[model samples]
Target chain A: MINYKTVNDNKCLVIEISEDFIIDNSDNIKLKDAINKIESLPEIAEIDFDTTALKSWDSSILTFLNHIKSHCLKHNIAFIKDSLPGGVQRLIALAEAVPERKGVRKTEVNRSYLASSVAAIGEKVVNFTKTSKDMLAFLGETTIAFARLITGRYKIRGSILMPIIRECSVDALPIVSLISCLVGLILAFVGAVQLVIFGAQIYVASLVGIAMIRVMGAVMAGVIMAGRTGAAFAAQLGTMEVNEEIDALKTLGISPVEFLVLPRVLALSIIMPLLCVYADLMGILGGMIVGVFMLDLNVMEYYNMTRDSVSLNSFWIGIFQSFVFGILVALAGCLRGMQCKRSASAVGEAATAAVVTGIVAIVVATAVITVLCNVMGI
Target chain B: MLWGFKHLDIKTASITLKNLTEREIGDIKVPPDLTVKNLPDSMKTPHIIVKNITMAYGDLVIQQNLDFTVNKGDIFIIMGGSGCGKSTLLRHLVGLQKPAKGDIIYNVLSKNSDLEQNRQKEINFWNTSAEEQRLLMKNFGILYQSGALWSSMTLAENIALPLEAYTDLSSSQIMELASLKLALVGLAGFEGYYPSEISGGMRKRAGLARAMALDPDFLFFDEPSAGLDPVSARLLDDLILELRQSFGSTIVVVTHELASMFAIGTNSVFLDPVTKTMIAHGDPKYLLESSKDERVINFLTRGEGKQIV
Candidate 1:
């Protein structure tokens, strides 16, 4: 319990803290009330602690005392703690021994909602312009690195290239296969449901084939690689930056773009189309499984229909989209990583940003290619 | 056949007896007429022996043929010119970077243990398995130049992390120990603050608190005073000396501060960037007074033209 009474003709306020003044007790309201009473008294010249009845205490009691101490300091009231226990006095002394460091606390500002919104929008616009400029700079650097690689100037070691190739291509197979096959199966089943009613169930093969070959397969692979390899590249490069390994490479006159980014870009670009083709085959096979078992169509008949429905133009477009997606994912990941601040948390933010950027780029590229294909009658 | 066996003190005799059981007394070879009076009052125990380590980063040799010994309970300073691989050598000693050639041997025997146990207990740091290396690393407390605290955790949580991982103490007990460690570094009430919330000097002190969390035997500090003002830097030097006096921990500090070197360093190795090797090794004060190497004198006096007398 906490109780306070004014003495010396209301000139001094004495606070009494008694039994079980620990953190567990719900006596905060009492403390707050006492503080309010002390604040209201204008003529009070001093505040004192009367702890003769105090039996037990902890950090909670210290915190309570600290609140009053701050209030007394603010009001220039003399704080007398002579009645408190020796241990409590010493703890209070220890806590105040190192003064609260100047300019360490973050200053909070209150602003109108409209003003805050305008400020936020201004910050976003500035950030967007900065990000765009950085992206263009990274793009130019990558182009130069590519030119050097083509002209027999920059040689990428097999040690670095091989691991990245394996990571984005071979290691990505299981997830890509699963997602593409599921997309094909869902397409086949949904088509079969409607075609069955119209007595055209065999059309499910063509429906699944055209969709998978033209876009679904590559899209699924792109999303999977974005989440897997893109995030990984960001995390790897971001950690290298944090460890000053990238700076070390720079100090040695080796361009990080050429040594680090080029290998990753080459690996991802070369593997994405191959993975996309493999994903197309897996998706067609998944469609066949549905057509043969679920729709009772002959396996060879379904395969022949798929071959007929998937045009060369659609297949080439899908490959091209996947290649572009690969380059985009790699660039996005590396760009975010290179831009990362030297902190542990920044690595995580970079990885997340890489995934988001990769996925968004894939979807936008898909949209533009679709519109172009329609306009050109592909 | 045991020449000094008769004059061996009780402690030394017991150690000799312990070794005698391991090896035949006839196999024990003692120097002629070696007596307690002639023997060293206390032998310097080699805690770490760097044997001809050549540090390199892919074809670029930073330092070569580097050999030194860090003795037990010694504040060993690794001082050199900027970019002379002083921090690199500390990294090698702490097992962060591998040496291009030779080995780093750690003597695992306690300071007061028998001298005969040195060879038997010696461990090749690089040759150990990953698990063994991790166990060895547990005894080391490293303070990086940037005070690399886990930015996400509060000072108390950062100090409590190793305790939580390696000990079975309750949460409250760990927190209390964390507070105690913070208090030792004069950051008593700043336990709830994050690393970014404090000043640079405070962050360094907090880093020291985290380093001492497990009460490690070896404390390695990289640039303990690089970013601090003179007053805080001096206070830190005093804190380091106090830590050594109280805990008797072997300290390896990578610093170029002449004041710090003379103030606390018991022994040191002067690394030469030009030669890519150490040019001098001994007590820093003694080296300052007696070393004939011009580079050593130039470095020790901060190139202010104080030649050896």
Candidate 2:
């Protein structure tokens, strides 16, 4: 609690602060009233602090006293700080030791929403162009490096290449298999339901086979690699960028792209088609399990129908799509990784961007390839 | 003093004795009348000669007209105010970034040859071929400010990577050497820990271990004492001193910490951000006592209120 009184025959204002003047009790104190009283009275020559009755205190009391001190300063009245505790006086002195720097605080600027939106859009367009130029340059460098490798001028150690291949292909097998198998089973079940309405449940074999071989199998593998391998590649390289390992490599006279990115891209390119083939076989097996057991079709009939429905043309196209997807995934992953800023959060954002870019590239490639195939009447 | 010589072996003591002046030997109350011509061969040779280099990022010049020589067995300190391109200067020396102007010449000798047979040969760093640059870089070990350990690799693997890349050492040999390097940095039994698994101090030690994996001729440290407690920083300084004493590797450090600067620095160059060039270059202690530049005196006697015009 705080109380004030006129002292020395109304010449001085004695402010008494007492009993737990902490943050919790700050709301109860009427600092405004005290300020108003000081302003109203012109005869008061000085203000004296009286905290002798205070049981305990904190910054709240210091702030209250500071407010009064500033008011006294403004009005040219004497603020006798001798009556306050030594700690309080020292703290006040310490707080005022250094003046606040100029122009440090940010002032809010009001602008129309349309003006702000247009500015933001212009900034985004500039950023997009810059990013595109960087990506094109990276692509050119990678291509030159790949050419160097082909001519046997650049030698990549087997130790680096082998591990990357194992990571993207062998280590990725279980996930790709699981996802592909489930996709095939869902397609078979859905196709089976419709076929049963026409008393043609046997055609479920053709439906599952053609779908899995033509596009679904490659698409599933592409999506899986995009999420799994692409994200991992981005995060790995992004973290390396953040740690200055890339700088270390450069100083060590090693090209970061050749030593790091090339191996990853080569591994994914070689492994994706192989993974797609494996995924296609697993997906067909999954459809067979449903057709033979649930649909009660003869195993031979289902097998023969699958063999007839899945043409070599479709098989080659599926392989071709997966190859394209592999390159796209690798490019997206490495692009994001190389573009990563030197920070922890940038690594996470790079990984997210890699996955987004990889999946979008896969979808767009799939759409274009399908349109081309339709135009060619294949 | 004799106390400083207590830990020195007889060979190093003799070397130290050859270089000691009357004042240095005065601490032991010894008469300095002996002729001193038997200095170590490395003492006279300059390891790196950074001649009039200008560092910049595009057109924004960080520092210009920098010239210094790092003698072998010298713990050279690139001392300066913050943002004065001290780290950038180290980067230029280490071949991470090329100077916009001027050349850095490295005086290297073949590893197996005797000192008499293989007099130091100068290799202009920037003008050398990629292969020659790689070979030159093999003899340099650098500790970055943030440790920069490969987060994906275990500490053991991080140290072993350089060994594996540059040496034909077998896996077992590489592992043993990696463990030995880790033990040297007082990080024994931490071989299995990844960079992210350890504390910042531990990671810095781990980075030091990796840098020393090849036992490079020159060691570059960018703020080795940063983000460390006073006690830890002191320990790091002692470790750096011990490494220099044991291996005789020429070390270059970039830092602003006065404590470590005074503790380990044998020679230094003070870069001034305002001037975009170095204002003082000499032994930091000597600079503190006798330098006429007010900025140098103010920097050395910071927080002591002893600013002299």
Candidate 3:
């Protein structure tokens, strides 16, 4: 066991610890409790340990000595270890050899809500600035890549581009068509309520046609593609980053943007308008279905009204919006992928961030384009 | 588990119900570590026996009819050119892969399980129960090539995880032991740093610290110097030597790094792809000086061993 003596009102506390200070023995229990008790007393100005009897100790004696050392360091108590074995002394010295490095530990202390909020806002502003700079740099690189493509200097492997094109276009068609169709149907139904009150049920077709052709079809498709294709792109490139393939490309003197990003972006941009036209067709059909079945309008009449109401100008506007959104989604996904850290979980985080960024870019582009469309009298 | 196990019939031995305490096991005198080239001594004292092992995938035999012995406290190297089933053999040794034909036996000298009586009946690789496997595993510690430290935890936390899972130590005690292990690996002040924050060499050392956390008797290193610089690799070699000196734990390293192979290796097995079995088996240094196989010579000397000097 363990023996302790209190001299001069605990100013000089002597702890004598002995043989086989293992956890299995009942000695560890008493020593553990005594160590904690001795450690807490502020009045104990000095601590001395006797460990010559520690014939075979595992973590128990080490734990006890560590406590005594740290307690002495904390309370400015003089720790005398002349009575301890050389090996135990050396072990203690080894464990305490390096004082903890400064600022390595993440310290979190309670702070006022206002203070924390201000700090958070400041951090957000810094992060926003950094992201803006990164986006601009990415755009510059993309512009250079596009210039190289126009000059026919950049290599575009048909194999890589073809699959991406199919995924972003053919693979995305069903969901995009379904969401756009539902959007058109909802628009028709809501417009029918007001149009019916005014005895102008035919104008409901114009409302559905204009809304779906101008913005609804493109926006719905944009959201769908952002969640589907953009996230896939990010995950793919993020995995490439993890495997150091992107670095390998750079080492081989081929720009990752020119080799990997350009093909994907170009494919998305090319297929986007085509998909929008398809979305527009699907949306008009959905509206036609809703009108003929729910509004007692004849199918031929509904078809004629839709054909008359939707202008080529509105269709072109929707196509242009979709093209821009496709570019933004590709850019957002690629940028996030390039920014991915070299770790397995970073790939997943990059994919999630890509989806968020893609949708945000689409929404923000929609707002800007809508204003520009209005001003330009599109 | 203690080490001097006697084989009765080389087949099976009944588990004796003697309650052998840790103190009693510790009192058993371990045979002094001698030169591994002593055949009779080593044959009688095989710490781990790879008996008639045949590693395969489907119909493809990676290596067949492989047999080897690793003695106690030996720094054993499993050396081969890339893709010669060296790692496959290591996987079999560590209980990760099942041998298509044979079983690996660890002759843990434990009295309670009557482990010594039947030549490793307690931990008969594929035949033993899951609990028996876990018990056998407690005596082992493996360090992967990538230093596979948990990315999320701090260095100290990663080291403390095994301690927390297996031991009854308090939080403060665990932290202290973690620091101790880290200090042992020359990573004293890096307790709070994440694996990502440290250099690749430091990460490997931290992994070593974690492996040594349970104070395991069998320590394994897989390509420990695969990605390390020369200085760091040499430092790792020194660390391995020190670990053997201090703890005297049996070390099994899987590497083809020649400098490391000749430096710390007390015994080694050379796996050849063409032969699809061990071409050479003996002490690495002894094989380097005496072995006559051309392939083995080419491998040992980094070129043609016969031609070089």
DockQ of every candidate: 0.02, 0.46, 0.01
Each candidate structure's TM-score, on Cα atoms with residue i matched to residue i, is 0.58, 0.78, 0.51
- Local lDDT at B191 for model 3: 100
For model 1, the DockQ equals: 0.02
Instruction: Decide which is better by DockQ, 1 or 2.
Output: 2
Window of ten residues with lowest summed lDDT in model 2 chain A: A21-30
Highest lDDT: which candidate? Answer: 2
- Tens digit of lDDT per residue, candidate 1, span A62-134? 8888888888899899999988899999999999899977887999778899999999999999899888989
Q: Each candidate: fraction of true contacts kept?
A: 0.00, 0.58, 0.00
Please state the error at residue A195 of candidate 3 in Å: 2.9
Candidate numbers, best lDDT first, in rank order: 2, 1, 3
Best by DockQ: 2
Give Cα distance to truth, residue B156, candidate 1, Å: 38
The order of the candidates by TM-score, greatest first, is 2, 1, 3
- Predicted candidate 3 versus true structure: per-residue lDDT over A1-378, tens digit per residue: 777887877798888777667766564567567767776676888887766676777766777677667767877988888788777778888988998878779989787999999999998998998888988999999999899789986657575589789989888888988888888888888888888898888887888888888998788888888899889989988877775456433422346798678988999889888888888888888888788888888888888888898889988899999999889889888999999997999999999999999999999999999999899997
Worst 10 residues of 1 chain B by lDDT: B30-39
Task: Give the DockQ (C-alpha) for candidate 3.
Answer: 0.01
Instruction: State model 2's lDDT.
Output: 0.85
Which ten residues in a row are the worst by lDDT in model 3 chain B?
B17-26
How good is the docking of model 1, by CAPRI class?
incorrect
